[model samples]
Target: MIELPPTILQIILNFSIGLIVTVSLNIEVGFLNLPQFGRLLAVLSGAIVAAAVPGRILAASMGLPWDANYAYHLYNFGIVAKINNMLSENPGLSIGILVFTLVIVALIGGLIGYLSAYPALRLKEAYLGITLLAFGELLMNVAWNYDPLVGGTMGVWVVDPFRFVGAGGARFTFAALFIFFIAIAIYIYAELLARSPFGRTLKAVRDAEVAASVYGKDIVKIRTQTLIVGGSIAAIAGALWAFFTGSMKAATYTRLTWTFWPWAFMMLGGIGNNLGVLFGVFLYTVSRTAIILYKGTLSAVIPIDPEWLEYIMIGLVLVAVVLFRPQGIIPERPTLTLPEHKIEMISKKFNREEK
Candidate 1:
């Protein structure tokens, strides 16, 4: 077996997280044609939940402080350290905390989605996008100011559910592998959802809302459902990110990283195509990682700041794709529900009848 380098492992981890979030965005913006400019809301929800909930639960169980003060940096660090110690010794408990956190994140994320549906019904296109974006920013600000929520500006340490795995490279590899596994599962789910009847309905609604309405499709219901599904999935990505990083800060979940980047990834990968999104995410993640790794070298050659190079490169790529390859590197293909032979036979019969 070949040993993977740390850089490669980091790429895998980043790719996995990006894939999960971008696929969730695709389900909404690509398939449903919803302008999801506030993808960060659900992601922040997940990260905040993952950061705030599980450790508190463990603390409470152990007769430690689990109240608002638990999130304070002074208490949070110690509490999380104790929790990590417990988690390291009990693999089963660690797994349970992981599952429990994800479940909570999904529920809260879905609720947020459902709540957004009211505004979604009223706002159209750009207005809706702006509303969603504002909502995410609002949440971020609240979390930042509210000391109880992930320690506000202080941040909080996340309970490491993967603590059972040995420390150093071994632990990082395990976490990366677990995240990759989840990414694959989400991809399969996205693909299946895309092929299902509901998926067809989403595309129909997206392409022609009036025609879909004429066909008796309830546009309101579909939009709500899509938001809930997408929100839940995005929340899972956020939770996984928190777990992988072993820390969480409300300020860390920014629009650029959680919302816009995913949008760029989805656009780069053929919109409405899960496989394309996967490829797009992997390509972008690796490229971004390489740029960061070689920032000093690039800075020596170019006058621009090293921090901005990645953004400039991605912006150029996005512009190039938009101007030249609007359909993306892998264009979206028609989903066929029937066998090729059957479709061909039906087509022939219809032609003969018309003749």
Candidate 2:
């Protein structure tokens, strides 16, 4: 059997993660006109919930005490190990846990979205963005200091479904496949929504809120719906992150990692174009992964620190993209709502009189 290079496997994993988050971020900033700078809030909800819930659920099932303290937290880790052993013996339990975790992640994510709309959505974009950013950081701080939330600063280990797989490469390969398929499913949904009437309303709202409101569209309703959907999708990334790393840390969901990079992916890909997200995420994730993987080798060839070199390169690439192709690699295309036949007939009618 041929094995994938670690770097290539890592790139695929990062791509899967970037795909979902970038696509969802597009829905809010591009489609909904909500510049959600704190978009990491939904993602944090997923990782935090994923950390606290499953461990507690499995613990309760095993009659282990679930409490707010370091001792119980250690006991919980033991329970997770015991559960992992049981899952190895019983595959059914593992499958159930996997499905249950994802569904709950979506629900909690949607709730975060619903709540976010209240405070920030009504404000102007500049203020709204700041509000959302603050909220995200505030929750992350709470999670970091609050032990019951996610074992506090110590973090919590999640029982990955792949634990039974045993082989490290096999586990990563399986996760990559899982993430790829899930990303595909999300892509299809985004494409369909981008072409639908509801999507048109969002575009209208994004273009001009006052104009859309004049046309009887409820601005609040549209924004709220967009947040709920986008948040739910983005949350999946956090759950997958937990599964991928086999643990959750509040620091892991920091604004820089979860929020900024996704915004970069969305902007570089074309703000309003879902298809552009695929290209953007691939380029960023692969290039970023390659840079990290070769940091040691590259440092030997250059006088600068590896970290500074990476930032310089990334900054240069971003500046070049902004200067050369401000609309991104694939600029946002006009939405087509007309039927194919109708469009063709209209074109023929226009040409017939001239001919």
Candidate 3:
């Protein structure tokens, strides 16, 4: 048995990954009303960049063949070892590279977001969702066949900048900062956005595009901005995951892991509710982790494969939640965007109606 403590820590690390994914998705679908089914595309951008960009940078710095070819892939692994040795010898460079990687990842992610908006500009919400999903699938196909992006199926060892902390401390330290600090910071930003006048405009557009336009809200701009911000955040989250795992495999960033699960989380945790998002993520993450962790123990008792059992249980929970609790665990509370006087007027009218 792999000791409960390490397993639990691993689960928490993965939970933070899911938490960031779900929250970013919530910004797209729940808050902004963009049905971003192709969110995986934005995320994969981070992974691809993580593999292709940073590796090239390190390779060039160390006076190696950093070109796009089989020769490069064959020798890059050795070069990476040297880079690690250098990082170990110079702690300052190690930390600096990690920070630099994250910064570059954010910029690349933002660029992906900017590009992802083109499809949304002309398509209706439903069509836009389908188009986005198709685009993601298309990108995956290309990446898999193209050796340069990430060695096709062979994948690549992503930069693990946290090596300075040693193996055990690295993951724990990253997980703590991301889950508690980064995730919470993003949540607060989302909440603040939701309560602002701008957030009210997003709701207006979401509720009725025609009405929003009539009232002077730029529907197109709002939607595009949402996609840009949401997609960028999603990419950073995905890239951070790649760095954490210390590898970049295209298949690992599949629709099921980064896309579908987040949709389920957003729905299960009341849409437009950040607190609800966190709770929903916790519930599903724990359940799924428990199933995977105890699979062997479970197989000894039950004949069915634990993998199959896990999927079945997840599907059942999703269906049950959708059918019985559509509004999610914490039902969305309506945003109070009106001015005090306007709110008072509405209250007075309701009181008058009762009398």
Candidate 4:
């Protein structure tokens, strides 16, 4: 039922957000071999902060009612509308809010990640994963119950930084383009990190913790660092999603949507491979969007309800990937630390010395 342009834009936006989150997951799970089942925690942190923080800052500065209860649904809509109105008039202020929200979200997400390191130090594998999952659920429950924190179960509205683009279709297009730009930036960062020395160290720790430790790598420190980076990045996705949707609900960031879906994307894209993950995200986003848009037609042929069709499709894809192509569509290739020419020169030198 949706029009083609809107559907295409929606797909791009979804793909961008998915890539950001999945790549963040890949950082911890793929590179460090950490079982990060609670990936939603960092994302929730970002969304809650985006929902709660920058809006309040803007509201207070503008002499709006930004009390502790500002996030309550009743007050939230009115205040955010005012904020958007103001932002629409001032492009610089709008951009400032976006930057400010990202910074705060990243810091909060990183803090949570650092705290998670405590458990990471003591627990291994499933235990660590369970602890992280519990952490995410705990935050969700708190946000849902704590009225001041994003209006509790009612959720809260977010400030539209892109309101400066005006109230038109162009706004959606600009937002989608900005989000895609961010996705590309994130992809570049992940690629560079994967090829960096720290990335190699992460691989070493992942492959053989004892060996890496013997080589003077601090296992605990490395994990803490990875979590900090991953958490910050994941939170950015959350904040961006809030901005794009123009609302935030604790209930929206579910384990199924944020955690498991990202895991599936990472697995399908080839875990530990940024480019592979990008491709995987694109494929998944397109397919998922198509199913959602055409669920009415699919419903007549399929026994399942249209509402649950996407879920079933995702589940089936996960299973098929696990059974047939465990390494994903694009399996992870060997990461080389040095340039080919440099390595060739070194090899020649070694050959001459041996002769």
Compute each candidate's TM-score over C-alphas.
Answer: 0.95, 0.92, 0.88, 0.95
Question: Which is better, 2 or 4, measured by lDDT?
Answer: 4
Off by more than 4 A, model 4: 1-4, 349-355
Worst 10 residues of 3 by lDDT: 1-10
Best prediction by lDDT? 1
TM-score for predicted model 2 compared with the true structure: 0.92
User: For model 4, where is the 10-residue window of minimal lDDT?
Assistant: 1-10
Model 3 misplaced stretches (Cα beyond 4 Å)? 1-4, 69-72, 169-180, 337-355
What is candidate 3's lDDT per residue for 1-355, written digit by digit as tens? 1223666666676667777778888887887778889989888887787777776787788786677752245765776676666665666876677667767877776777777788888887789989999888888887777877787777777766666655565545654455446666777887888888887787778878898899888777787788777877787777778777777778777887788888887788777787899888888888888888888899999999988887787677689888999889998788777777999999999999999
Whole-model lDDT values for every prediction = 0.91, 0.83, 0.76, 0.90
How well is each residue in 26-113 modelled by candidate 2, as lDDT tens digits? 9988888787898789998888877777767876787766566422466657767776776666567877888799999999899899
lDDT of 1: 0.91
User: After TM-score superposition, what is the CA distance of residue 331 in candidate 3 from its true location, in Å?
Assistant: 1.4
Q: Model 2: how large is the Cα RMSD against the reference?
A: 2.9
